[model samples]
Target chain A: MSGVWGHSGNIEPMFQSATAEAVEERLQRPRGWNRRNSLPYTLVFLIVAYLGVFILFPIAQQFLTSFSNNVVGVDKVTWVGLRNYERLFEDDDFWFAVQVTFTYMVFVVAGAVSLGLVAALLLNRKFRGRNLARSAIAVPWAFPEISAVLVFLWMCNPTFGVLNIFARLFPGIDANLNWLSDPNLAMPLVIALSIWKAFPFTFLVILAALQAIPREIYEAAEVDGANPLQALRHITIPEITPTLLLMAVLMSIFSFKQFTLIWLTTGGGPYGGITETLVLRIYQTAFRFFDLAYGATLGVSGFVIVLGLTLLFVYAQQRQDRARRR
Target chain B: MNRPGNGLLLPRSLSMGRRDFLKRTAAAGFAAALATPALAQNAKIKIPLVSWMWNEPGRGDAWRAILAKFHAEQSDVFIEEAGAPFNEFTNNMLIQSQSGKINGALFHTTPDLVVRLLRGGHLEPLQDIVDKLGIGDKLSAAHDHLRIDGKVHGLDIVTVKFGLLYNSAMFEKAGLGAPASVEEWVETSTALTKSPDQFGIYSPHLMSEPGDFWFILQQWAVMFDGVWAEGRKPQVNTAPVIEGLKLFKTMYDKAMPKGTDTATANQMYANGRIGQQLIVSAAVNIWSSSGPDIYPSLRSVVPPGPSGKAITRIHPICVNAHASDDEKAAAKLFVEWLYKPENYQELMERCLDVVPPYPEAIRQEYLDKQFWAEGYLAGKSITPLEIMGDYIFFNQEFGNVVMDKFSEVLVANRPVEDAMADAQQELEKASERLFEGFTL
Candidate 1:
């Protein structure tokens, strides 16, 4: 019997050895291969075919569509090579979208990660109802995005919102502060809502990493007269550097592609496309204006920007991993 | 014989029956998957309709019941509903148009969208539908907006007339009557306003999706006799337009709920805290549902301005040009069935926001059931058909320019002249680029 009790403590290593042997045997043989290993080969073929049809094909199609005069819903395609790109470069709206997108990404990434790290540190400490606190912290992340957005929109109402009601108590704050309509405050409020919705996953990840750290290392550091701040700087910082770097890359990617939060709240308005992110601009160009080719061009440009950032972060992470190993 | 990279060889002792069974199962699954769509294609004459009306509460069930009745009457025909949220339906139509494969045979959308679809040549000519019905003389003046080159392109089901919808209770409480001109309008709004709690007026002054700021602000623009376009050329940045922009800015500052969009404004108005607003005829039903006492006290007047005109829009139904012949025939049949006098007025009454496009629809029996009948028919001081003089379709080109520049002026507090000039230049550029070779 291969059950745990029957095989005793050494079963794991034995199972690993058997898996290695099976792989070696499979590699060494060549005759009747289709009949012998049909299942895995069929599974892999299915996966590749699925990805090629749904994922890679659309991406390639978009790249080709960007150069053509494919006016949406019309059965005509005129090849207009590089003119779409030229137009994209010249358009003032495109540049404004780029500037706003990067600004939004930076603020959201920093705010979400910092808040997440703080929450993680607090929850990691031993206390009563710690488990309950951990569960409660995840509620924001689990909340439906549309529901949260609607609630926030109501709360930010200039006339009768709870937020405006509270603001009246402060000495200098305008009682009827237009949080969403004011161009100055709209983006900040959008960013705060995004941070609230996204920080929980970061909190959970950081908490797991924190719990994995050796208690003995912290105890020794304390015995040597190291204070909490010193321990955090020398021990916690170095230990969690990899996770932090990873989270930064992921959060940056998420922020750059975010559409629903910003679109639902501001829709690039209160003024003329002031809050328009690249994704929102692409949607407007494609669906609203029906300039399909121009929208595709904008999409490709955004993809390149995000891909470049991702590669840079990955390279940095690799360098850090090498330094840690040394 | 096998190649090196082919990996493991099967033992000669392995059974062939198991392998055959698996192969047969996979083949059967693939065949079944391929057969489903083929079977659907040949089943019945399915006429699907893509519309946002199904998003309304009672309308969805009414639509389904109508379709069921049609199906029962015509056993060979199937009516498929492809209803979605407004934004999603618009997006779906765009994608379908790009792919040149429209899923629905018929579609229902606003006049603005009808113009866009017509410009793209995505709509089938509905002149035959009108000619056969012989209701050309009965058609309202608003149908002029749906005609292209003397050919009917779509059929109007319902329309919204823009006017001043006021809470009579508030007006009485403030010892004010409905305003007749621009100055009176402002004075009444200010008199009715009592800071922080009760706003005198509620309209979406911000650029909002699903509802453009222009829809509300255009009433003011038209009242001031500002022409948005003459032929294909932009006539913005005129003196009248500048005056209209200034009036809107003042209204925003003195009366409107700051930073509120249409949804918020609608909610506030429904709660009876708002005094008056530029609202559509359909909103009477919406407000009535929220406050029973408020409905009885509600009153409407053609909002006064220099020209004494306001903006009104009609939503229309159009057939997909790409639909198959059978589907098109079925769609026509369904529409004919839908507009039979008994069915048409009953459906219109269920949703009080929309008025039927036919003048005959306002027959005494229909008005008796309509909640806004007094404002719409009896007094008839609000002349929706003739008040605006001509029915001009608000196309995407004009909408984009108006919404953006107006937002900059109203929300950003930009100088009216500079902003209007910017809007004029943008409109000219768009016309030059978009309408360069097209027949307007």
Candidate 2:
């Protein structure tokens, strides 16, 4: 070929430059787009519109109503400017509701996350009928809340409930135990039910995180003379720490807003507002008493507190990320 | 086709006449279309009537039948029964009234709730309707319970008398007679109770359900001649009130099922485990229908309180303030028909235990029923229409306050005196808040 066209090699540079010019000319021209290009923009607009109509508008209206006086059997609303908040602070029932809510949140979050972690660890290992066991564990979460609550109410009945019958079999335990009506036992029972309902989500999330860790790392640790405990501590724990933090935040939010199970079971209780949380208080204030303004104030206060905790969680996550990067 | 310049076209004068005829026809057709709806409306009047009685299975069906009859008789007027369960209907009505959009032309509620609604201007003054229908002469003296400041705002469709209801089988099994006084009630309850298997008495004692709890406590107070309020001010810490509360606590501890609500307790009663209940007469109708096996064993008598007084209520109904004038007229006509002797007898017969205040409606044959013996009928003479004076005007919120504190004593073992004192304070605060500008 070189002998056939000795001058072809000398023209190669010119050929390459001409091809480069053709590509540059194409790149310089504007792109022609069809309707397909607008898909992402349309999706974003739809999402924003849905959030605005369903979520943001109601929240903003609630916030505004919190500052006004909307009494029962009256239509006129007068701007009172934090008077409802002032009154809420002075109200004894409000404080009791706060105490109940915080206590419930702490117990539920700790119990759910700890139990979920234990469940995740068990499910991650190979066992006989392992899939069946995992499915069985999710049964409570899948059961409808109201239906489960009714079953629980029956089980906790003093006379005919199965729980009392079981408790009686143990020595020194009273057969006529009023499980739901007893002030001392009501909150604990509520917390248990909430954990039973919520822990499955945490379990599933943690299990996914656990399975994603490289098995080779554990095998390598084993070859280097590290035991199972040491490997779990140094590798597994650190890798899944972010998932645990996020689950805790999620469970806290869910427990704080719990209404149906608690409302249906004891209706905040056998008396003395023993099990009434902030959300139950808000419902009672708005629907039962028809004091929408005060209820809105309570809702707003709960929202602010939850927001602050979420921000704290975010800060902790950022610090962990920075430490890992370093 | 004919052109304007064609010789075959119509003359200008003849074309103008034809255009005028077409215009008149079009105008007439438009006017007829517009007037058709008005003509149909004038022919028939439909009034929406919402009833809390819809929650009562037997009574709801009975009332529907009566409304159907009225619809048949008055061909021009119709009653549309908007059905909702009692609790939901009450809440929805209150909300609708407050929102200035009452859904129905007429509503049936308890006397106390009616008073509060009247004060809130949710009910129209029925004085005109009452006078026009001659209802004042036809109605029993119990109708006075519906008046506020000399204006009749409601009419009583039915009245309930509260009394001691005992299972005759249980009484026979325990070898105890009916309780004739508060002490006897305690003794009878204690004698009949055997934990887990059977219990002595049943009452709705959950403070969270304040309305029912307050009604029960009001009955207790009335029996002891104890007053919780004098006009607008609260008198919760008085000796009689405290004594009555102490009695309640003792009954809860010793005889009644602890922490059991009325529904649970009624289940116990229906199963023949409960000895007695201080229930309204109408409850017998429900118990009989649900548990027919226990019907023969049930007997009722006026609750023998220490004061020789009893608590009863006149179930009153009112026209909604938001009702149109035509709707109001139809509603008044319906009420008038309901109070007529022949129609009233039919209503009384349909609702087994509920007694119409009208003498002609109270038949001797109904009194002979196992559940409605002479003992239960005796209360019609002395049962008081008004309860605890201005307690009716205290609204449901005041009851909530009292019940909240009332719960502490029953659940937490707080002293009756302390709980009553706390209740007094809370009631005063509530009264100051709820009844600010009006006289109780």
Number of the predicted model whose DockQ against the real structure is largest: 1
lDDT of 2 at A30: 53
Give me the displacement of residue A6 in model 2, in angstroms: 55
Per-residue error (Å), model 1, residue B168: 2.0
| TM agreement with the true structure for every prediction | 0.84, 0.84
Rate residue B350 of model 2 by lDDT: 81
Which residue pairs come into collision in candidate 1?
A: A73-B97, A73-B98, B282-B353
Clashes of each: 3, 0
Per-residue lDDT tens digits for candidate 2, residues B1-440, read 43474566876655556679899889999999999999887888887778878668888888988888887887878777774787686677666766666787888877656765776677877777667756556656666756677667887777776777889898998899888878888898898989867988877776445557777777676667776677667877888778788888888888887766566777889999898777777777788688777778988777666665556677777888767888888887787778676887788778775566656656666655545444456653332334444545544556666777777787778998998888787777766665544453
TM-score of model number 2: 0.84
First chain of model 1: TM-score?
Answer: 0.88
